[model samples]
Target: MDYLELAKTVGILTGISGGLALLMSIAQNTIGNYGEKEITINGEKKLIMDGGDTLLAGLIDNEVFLPSACGGKGTCGYCKCKVLSGGGQLLATETGLVTPEEAAEGIRLSCQLKVKEDIQIEIPQEYLDLKQWETVAYRIDDVTPTIKRVFLRLPEGEEINFKPGQYVQILAPEYQGNDEEVYRAYSIASSPSKKDEIELLIGYIPEGIATTYVHQHLKEGDTLNIIGPFGHFFYQDTDKPMIFVGSGTGIAPNLSILRYMQENDIQRPGIFLSAGRKIEDLPMKEEIDAIAADLPNIKMIWSVTGADPGTWDGPTEWVTDGLKKLVDDAKDSEAYLCGSPVTIEQIVDVLTEKGMTEDEIFYDKFQ
Candidate 1:
């Protein structure tokens, strides 16, 4: 058998298939342009955008931002908006993400819904005022072996307004061998009062596009595009006591909320637990300790799952265990959680079982 010859033929076919896919995409975006169509937003503002693109892309191109972590990919499901009319049927990619209620109420993933015909959609009025920033990468650091700590500087004399625990979408440009430009959302780690510069913690995720670009290609002083302050997951200004649970880079927004509490002299009782595989995986420890020191009401707990007992002195248990022990104020406290979907869901179950209502809990799950 001519095995070598067969291998060569298979390789040739694979290359041709990839090339054809790229060509199809170009044709779809350009030659397939459906001309211009009017998008009536909330029946208040109307935008004229060329068809053949996702409604998400059209809205973004027109400076209206929606919370999308996976760009126009149908995976994130963060781009859900109601289409009052003219939005086609839901795509297969969205079936797993949208709930039955959402599907019944005209909710659709904007990234999967094409701008065919004139579409009338419902968008939150606040989204109309969202801002985009062209900033300089002020500084970058390898905070951990896998995590890069970045500080993006807003323009001189300009400040961004964001609530604690909110996140921003960073535009990851095509770099090195990467061929696509996509935006990935990350929670802001720095205090909102800092204003001029926002800090982000990005953990390298093997071949993940955004993490690869941030870890391998981005450099200090480079220009970065930012769109945000998106997501409903944020600090709620209530008199209730608070419990914050986070893991890995999920700690970003939790720390932001803690810093806000310290800076603003918010003295409500608070319990913060940040979990990681090892002690080093937990970033910004000293700053968190400082915040705790300033606010007597704040109690800090570090949960390490895989750290050596001789080297680490903190609790060596899952966040759920730590949560069970420390959530004494559950019924009177609001809980903030951030982590992977499984972790967030597990913690939510614990919180609810511990007497915290769903209304008293907020979370940001990294999909």
Candidate 2:
């Protein structure tokens, strides 16, 4: 063959070989049957999976799914398990969450820990109560221009029991543009004192699956499935003065906490500061005002980032800036905060700088 023909022939052969190599690699990784082995989980004897896969996948493959919010992404430190024995050395990806003591105790991020041999593991007790629920959307109301209040009542008799500040993961069902079920977390806006119904304050993000569905495509009586009540973000039983700060959907869990305090007649002295881009962004101002009015010890301050001249009268600055003027010192107060990671970091820095002890500051941040 001539030069051009010979080059074309070599390219075709290379492509075929590449395809075969890819197929063989996939087959070697997933197609063959992994041999049987006895694995002990939390002191319970069980026969399961054989070698060469991460322990998280092995457990899931054997019908035991861990509490992994990021699927197998390992970015979330949620998939932690205590490997009593047979687990190898600590993994690099898990070192951030697991301390040296914890590593010595055999605590490892299950997603990053591989199951080469039979192993034992322990999960948090609270996770045992976690479950996935399928429900129908009962209502949707615009809480603000950018925030939607979604109410989902369990099917005729199904019920959910969760704390007020807890959150749930909504499965973004496959739609025209996406084929995978994406899981997004949202706080429970309703009071925990009530059961059988759940409420969420969903903030819209353009092209975001769950947010888009809640804002546009979702209708009353649509089927939805979710799992959670995951994070521990609630009020502590203390009489310390409270300082609450939130913006955007971060307002979701804080609202629940305030409502819980109101419902229980908690008269602990406190101030709540909420931030928004404009007056229209203040979703539940009226309700919040009503609660404050009813509770003489509670106060509310609303900060608008981009206030209109001659239209808005609230503090015209960032939320943290306004909060700085409220208290000269936060040394004795307890703060409850929720928001994006950047927002949380800013607030935490300010609180610490203002003399608030590390123990007095608590936050629920979205990662």
Candidate 3:
């Protein structure tokens, strides 16, 4: 082996790598420096911010919270705003998330848009009222064999107002062995009428950061940080028949919607379909069944993809199959679905094929 030659090659490669990193840093400080910029939102509020940060970050820093389930990772597509001016041009990263109609209206993902200059934009008026609540973990219960329901109580003299079926982002701070502090979105399982506290149904993923913290580290009376009711997936006040398909922890939002429906005496025909791998996989059945019994026109259906023949006698089918077989008013009824991305896509396809238009189908995909 030529030791001297090997050392020379290694030295040359290291030097080149170091030089590239230095050049990148220099470029960031020089070409990428955006200096101070003004962000005018809805033509009512103005904020001065650094140009190098994302529009989402700037807004959040200014106490204007927008929902970003992916936390500004260029995914989730929740943090969208109308960039009325000075947003330059749309980038490839936003093409998949923003539709043509949205693009034509200058809508872009706030996380993907950098504040490069004085920017004028428009956002939902409600976002200005968002608050990061400091609450307590009042109780945690096993909603199912694999899922847990976390009950959070607002601090004294405080309350959270939200539409049933909407979700909130909870912060999972850095704990022992895990250094990442991430915020995760969870659907509110409790009724919105319960203003003092809210409930969330969380399924324990083997190593999921937020779920791990919730199932393992979170405890009663523990202080928890929560953001606002930040999702479009909510019960719409309409007379159209409702078809709700939820799987796994996706049942959380539907539970909220159903409870709200019962509380408000919403009488339009409704069906709640709960799907899982087995009977034990189902969550919140007794409560849902009770809610169903209260609603005059509501029916509850159970579908299991993997049925235990010895102990389970329910229909062995997917929720998508149940959605197709049970829904009769797909052409006019509204469908609200929640679950994994693939499951939501399958349900959407089934509903659309059954004569439902895209606008009639709404979903909150657990991404």
Candidate 4:
């Protein structure tokens, strides 16, 4: 009644347990596997990518770099795309960023929308042509106490053909205590004419991943990976006079536009108003002055908000104030502004009050 009966019972129990374990392993693999999915863009192009990633990330992996100021954090609301079908449902984060009409029209924040299955999306044709470039940090110079001018040289046979005011995303590799890779966008300060080289005016935010990496860890000749030529903020072709405004590192894009205008001999009259906390905080003044000297129709004005009226030679007011003094009629002019959201909003209100319509003003709001 003893040994043989006990061994038989033990063998049966062990067999059942091993079968259950094998079944569980099969279920995990099947349920968790999100295999390849198709992404049809603009009803014309189709991409086959691995599923289970966000739409923003999938698009980036496929070499389509969308404009995302917050680097897929869903805060910038810049990576908006239209999903005709198969995007699942609207997320609260997406709803907060897009309006009701936009949501109804299939507009969604790409960063918040996951691609679990086949999907159809519509993006601008320009985005289809975007490319990721491999570059090297050729040089770094301190433009201001908090700003560093980093120059990047593209690899052989590679060149970035971006508009003057467009921006590029720099990859922040794992370093020090930060173990995850991330990206941050910075406007290209160098002219588009300089195809092989791009410059970024990066402002160091306390403990910022990309900025801190550039400021402290990134050295000349270090390899850098960047995806570029994003954003709609750029010089528009119009015969109407132009007004350019910027603050801090916001001057990066404006400088690119100005250089393009000067190099190409675009004779359209332009007035650049740059503001900073103090005179010393305004970087690239010499470069701006030299560009303005060659372009007779271009005028440069510098303003410092936190400077003493008696000591500073430049205007002791906001750049918008300097803008008001320079132009009397804003009705016929187009205004381009770049700065923090608050600063852009204030300048926009000023421009509107001066008779410029909302559509006449184009701005890039730094998040």
Q: How many clashing pairs per prediction, in order?
A: 0, 0, 0, 0
Q: List the residue pairs that clash in candidate 4.
A: none
Better of 2 and 4 by TM-score: 4
lDDT of 3 by residue, 1-367 (tens): 4999999999999999999999999997889688999999899899998888899888877878888788678879889999999988998999999999999999999999988999999999988888888989988999788799889999888989999989999989889878987778999988999998999998898888888899899999898899998888898888998888887799888889888988988888878788788787888778788888889697888877787668777767788777777776588889999988998888888888888999988899996
Model 3: CA > 4 A from native: 1-33
Better by TM-score, candidate 2 or 1: 1
Which residue runs of candidate 1 sit more than 4 Å off their true CA positions?
1-31
The TM-scores, one per candidate, come to 0.89, 0.83, 0.86, 0.89
The Cα local distance difference test for each model comes to 0.87, 0.79, 0.87, 0.87
Please provide, for model 4 over 1-367, each residue's C-alpha lDDT reduced to its tens digit, 9 standing for 90 to 100: 6999999999999999999999999998777468988999999888887777898888878877788778789999989999999988899888779999999999999999888899999989988787887799999999889999999999998889999999988988999978877878899988999999999999999988888899989999999899878888898989888989987899989889888988898988878888888878999889789988988887888888888667687677787678767777889889989998888888888888888998889888887
What root-mean-square deviation over C-alphas does model 3 reach? 4.6
lDDT of 3 at 271: 81
